[model samples]
Target: MKSMKYFLLVLLTLMGAHYVEARPVTLVTLGNSLTAGDGDDGIGGGYPTRLVSKLQTANPGSVLLQFGISGDTTTDLINKQLTPAVAALNAAPSANRKIALVWIGSNDFFGFYNYTITEAWCSGMGLEACENSEFGASADNASTILAALQATGAALYIALLDDQSKRPVITEPALRAATFPNISDEYAARMATHLSAYNSRVQAHADTYGAQTVDFFNTTIFEAPATLSDDGNHPSGAGYDAITDIWHNAVTGSSPSSSSIVPNSH
Candidate 1:
């Protein structure tokens, strides 16, 4: 009788352990308007939200907590949010935590706009403006955020900013005619120069902190059809879906297996 009781106790303990191990993971997303799901026709369905939906279907029970605000620069995240949130999560009792997705820096680039210029000078036109945007994240600031997050011991996924030059707000014919009738490709190239610098900084920080970098910069949504969004910039629902596919693959460590998961035509 004594041996049977001991055997039963051991079996019950093993079952409990298995149950605990099967629990879903908890994730957090931190960033700005893009993270907040801005241009998705008010669905609040930005890439992060799309990502959450994908993860839930792929791995049931995974929960995503969002801490994003519109127009938030990288500096804002580090100063106003990241530290406290990290502290709170660290204090939580849950052991099945997985990843933190960070997507910031668009505002930093957009905030560079000062006045209309020919495309010929678009690249340099924003240089002075970019340097002056107080909210912009210097390379050092990005590194700091990465290091702080790393200290919390969570897996990190960092996204690079999309090319801002493609946004309709900057490229629309009507807006361009009204704003700067003589826009030149040079102006666009100059803007690209500054954007490249900022993106490189972000990539360097991710590399330094050992975080995986999502290559949103060169994706088809931005490069092909270039008309990804009606607005010319923020990804349409379809655009966000493409981003979702990229992130899903990054997290799952496997290529997306079906077209059902791919973003529908825009």
Candidate 2:
């Protein structure tokens, strides 16, 4: 009788362990240049990488995947990447896998040259320009991409575009001379207006999809001219690190190393 009781206890413990292990959550990031870390040496060490590192440190068992690429528009992702990736994730053995991060739309705004003639010059020089000239999902075709991702039952986190006016590259005299004959305060304000509409659309989509939104728009670091890199657009390594912290807080509901508990979505 004593032996039987010990055997049953061990069996139950093993079963519990198996149960917990069966439901692994998989996090995936989808986006364009910013998501791909284009301006940051092309190693893909952008915010997604940092976000994954932080999450893994916090939750040892969670799996993270990045599917971001340089110069991919929302239309491109929806047509080329999103479906295939999600299908594969669904087929995986872990029934509890979930997507957790998605940041896009900077390219959409930047492509349009909304702020100044510099963007136009860059496009003229064969650099990637914002394709969404019309503004919002209508412009970038984000609506379909967002909807499909949400349909997969993955919990999502969406980040707003960083303030473009604060980018250092835009103000660089040399780059300015190369890209635009004249970049004025009026041009900057006009660009902001267009980009703001895009950000608003992103937020609206997030709400529609039940995704949590992170507002980089109002963040001091993202809006500070000095925090950007030489190009004046992409975040420096330090800036990316700060963004990682913000994402960590938004998703996990606690700062790094804090005792705050993240609730399971199940």
Candidate 3:
């Protein structure tokens, strides 16, 4: 009877261990308006919320903790969001898998084009030099955010920023005239080049730290009218849905480039 009782205790212990190991994961997203679901016309908070639902379907009981502030730049993320995110990840159950997703830098570009130029923040520095300095800062800030998240032992996914220069706010003449009459063709061209370099730096950071990159470069969501919000900047409900699929695919080891996931309204 003593031996049988001991055997039963061991069996229950193993079952408990198995249950702990199989607990659903925790997802923490850190970013700007895009991650905050600014233009989402739907009740779903944003891609993070949509993603949590998808995650729960596969691994029920999954949780989402999002830190997305509108108009936040890479620097703002480091200053405001990173600490809270790290704390949350550290507080998560050790047995549950933890993941952090970072998507930012749109406002960095916007600030450069809109405020920097208008205010002449780099008046004497020359446009090329000013761009290099600004973009370099953005890259470094992003690297810092990624590195800190990695330290929490959570799987990290960093988003490659879309080229903001191509968004409807810039490409559409009417929108440009209404919103940013000061942004000339030359400035727009320079922005495209700098944004590309910034994305390359982000990719390098992900590679160095073994974090996966969620590609936002080749998507039509920004260019497509249907996918863009009424503001012509942030993603709409359908666009957020599309973004959710991309992140989901990246997490699941599937090709995120599937046409069904990234829709082209063109």
TM-score leader = 3
Candidate 2, poorest ten consecutive residues by summed lDDT:
15-24
TM-score of each: 0.72, 0.73, 0.86
Please write out the lDDT profile of model 3 over residues 32-132, one tens digit for every residue.
99999998997659899998877776667789999989989898999899999999999998666788899999889888887787656697888778889
lDDT, each prediction: 0.64, 0.63, 0.81
Tens-place lDDT per residue, model 2, 1-266, is: 99985675577467542112223457777877666665554334787887766666645566667787777766667776787757755655455457657677665555455342355554564522333334645434555666777777777777777666555545565655555435455655566776777777777777777878887888866545555566656666677767778877776654566722243442
Best-to-worst ranking by lDDT: 3, 1, 2
**Better candidate number, 1 or 3, judged by TM-score:** 3
In lDDT terms, how accurate is model 1? 0.64
Q: Pick the candidate with the highest lDDT.
A: 3
Cα error of candidate 1 at position 59, Å: 2.8
lDDT for residue 65 in candidate 3, whole number 0-100: 97
* TM value for model 3: 0.86
CA RMSD, predictions in order: 8.9, 8.0, 8.2
Off by over 4 Å in 3: 1-22, 255-266
Candidate 1 or 3, higher lDDT? 3
How far off is residue 114 in model 2, in Å?
7.1
